[model samples]
Target: MSTAAIDVRGLRKSFKDVAVLGGVDLRVESGSVFALLGSNGAGKTTLVRILSTLLRADAGTATVAGRDVDRDASGVRAAISLTGQFAAVDGRLSGRENLVLIARLRHLRSPGAVADELLERFSLTEAGSRRADTYSGGMRRRLDIAMSLIGDPRVVFLDEPTTGLDPEARQEVWRAITRLAADGTTVLLTTQYLEEAEHLADRIAILHEGRILVEGTLADLRSLLPPAHTEYVVRQPSLEEVFLALTQKDTAS
Candidate 1:
């Protein structure tokens, strides 16, 4: 049986009169990529913050890596890493420096070795010596994620890691995320891109109006849509479909 890496029950959070997470409930299996799909102001970030112990929940309970977020905030924080929507690399530092700084902060025995290993793993070795300000969006985001792995936390929370990147850059980050899951790191990703969830997540949850409308595997979600009927006619693609198909080709090529 798969273990539950993150478990939430009746989670409620609000900012004054505004309810962000309205009695939400969720479960994420260990060593799997779980994507939370939502629109702007849908409380995705708020839920992530609560799970990461960065914010308090108004009610309900959340446990991450077997640690209760409210009662054992320190334990929960120690077992997970969070990457917000924006890359948080220091522009003044080199990519190598950024990783080394984080490893040292985590009190790793050999920060240099840790940095070097991550630099190679993220394909940033060639750019490791250059200042972070000189890196492309993808490189910076990769470095940000590398820094988050210094302590090999059990779970990772990524809040729209590809938000402002071009298609190519987004694809680059997607590969890195795949590697994380392959290495048995449980990941909770929040993304507005349906294609992203379809491509990367083992299970997906759609959040709306501060609650989960549905949660299941891609096949399960697809089953919710009406079954297609067989047709012998060729159909023209919709404008959105054309745009997506073209963009996918552009990224792949």
Candidate 2:
């Protein structure tokens, strides 16, 4: 198997007269969390769709989880799962039921066992039996994520999973992503939330105009910007300053 979790070279995509992605290239290390950050309409969603095998690039060579995405499309599908901006659970079914259905859809050998494990893994055990329609957005998203893991995929693609969520719900989703990474799952995350990327990404790549503008560890990225741009004023510092200090400390330590 290839060592890189995701590999893309000269990836390009176009729709009608406009180019959505232009010669984009990315390499994500195995078992690490990589975040793609860009503003609205920056081709983040287009890139995610291509990597997850939901869409084909107009021109590029890409491989995901050791399989050539274009030639080995089935292999890519088998090795990865995708969670979009919206939850994908059946509202009429309870959370547990939704998970079970997903397991079955994936043709897992033991759907019940997979559902049970996912429920526990996602901390939805107590709420597993509640109808998905009755659950909070966070709970629904948890179930959506849990369902994605039904086949125990090696790579997961989350495309703005916390978008449009309340603060508390967004935090819950963040925790879920943290736990998934802790368990050594390779994650390719695309989000417009700068703080979220700073908090969870092992490495971050900033995409603009469908191309990478900067890519590195958080500290390395900060270095690209002006110094004192991230001032560390402990007492009476603005929240932004405090955030910078804390993030720098966390990165440094």
Candidate 3:
């Protein structure tokens, strides 16, 4: 049986009468990739924030890595890392410097060795000595994620980690994400790119109107659609096509 790295029950959050997360419930199994799918303002980031201990929930409970997010906030923080939409790298510092800085702040011994290890792990060793400003979007994002792993946090929350990057750069980030999962790190990724969820997630949950409309493995979710028959050519629709169809059906009903 797989243990849940992150769990939530009846989570609710609101701002001035606006419900951002209205009774959200979710679970992410340890060492698996769980993707959260939603459009803009669907409260994916809000949920990630709540789970990561960055923002408090108005109601309900969440536990990360066996620690209660509210009652054991520090413990939750210690067991998880968050990579937001933007790459949080300083242009003035070299890639190695950034990693070393984070490792040092985390109070880990041999910060230089820690930085060097991550640099090689993320395939940034060749660029480690270069200033972050010189690195491409993908390289910078990889460095940011590598820095996040200085303490080997069990759960990682990535909120649109590949946004604004070109296709090639996106692939680079995708490889990094794959490596994270291969190393047995639980990832809860929020992405608007349906193809991204299709490629990386072990299970996916669709968030609509601040609630989970559906949750299942890709094949399981695909079962929600009726089988198609073609007379001339049999074509398989992509995840984007299926997602749009479902969401439109939901909205139209």
Candidate 4:
């Protein structure tokens, strides 16, 4: 059995005349949170969809949780769960009901027990009986994530989990994601929020122009560019100066 949560090499994809992904390679260790950072339309979603078996790559090999994405799609789907940019719950259904439905879909025999556990775990116990449409944004997001955990997925793909959330709500979701990874679940997170990646990722991979511009730990990546530091003269030190120095920016700091 392979311990790697995900492995991809020479991954290439194209949408008609445009190349979306060009020779991408990634290797995520078991139980680690790997953040793939990129701007809009940078193929981050495409990569996540392909790994979660929602989209197929035009070329190259990929595997997830020891199952080949191309040859063993079922196995990959069985081992992975996807929480998209938007909540996928049925708004007409109650929180607990949504979880039960997904549990059933994943063929869980003890769907009731699973639903209760997740409801409590995600702090949705009070709202579990409420219709998803009536729930707040945070509550709905929690339900969406809880639904994905119905079958104890080994790997999860989170694409912009906090896209439409306020600061507090985003922090709540971040904590939930941390808890998931701490419990030995491998997470492939793609987000435009650099601070979010810095907070949660064990390693970061930046994608630009359909290729990985860089990949490394936060500290390591910072070191790669330069060793410039800033000593703020003002009593209230600004990170802007430090950032500019580190990034080798000549914007007159």
Models 1 onward score TM values of 0.92, 0.89, 0.91, 0.89
All candidates: CA RMSD (Å): 4.9, 7.2, 9.4, 7.8
Best by lDDT: 1
- Model 2 TM-score is 0.89
Q: Model 4, 108-181: lDDT tens per residue? A: 89898899999998989998898999988878888898888878889999999999899888988998999898
Q: Candidate 4: where are CA atoms >4 Å away? A: 233-253
The per-model lDDT (C-alpha) reads 0.96, 0.91, 0.95, 0.91
Indicate the worst ten consecutive residues by lDDT in candidate 4.
244-253
Candidate 4 similarity to native, TM-score: 0.89
Tell how far residue 141 is off in model 3, in angstroms: 0.6
Worst 10 residues of 3 by lDDT: 226-235
Per-residue alpha-carbon lDDT of model 2 for 118-222, expressed as tens digits?
Answer: 889988989888888999998899889888877779999999999989999999989999999998899999999999999999999999989999898999999
Q: What is the lDDT of residue 126 in candidate 1?
A: 94
Candidate 4 local Cα displacement, residue 30, angstroms: 0.7
| Candidates ranked by TM-score | 1, 3, 4, 2
The candidate, 2 or 3, that scores higher on lDDT is 3
lDDT (Cα, 0-100) at 205 in candidate 2: 97
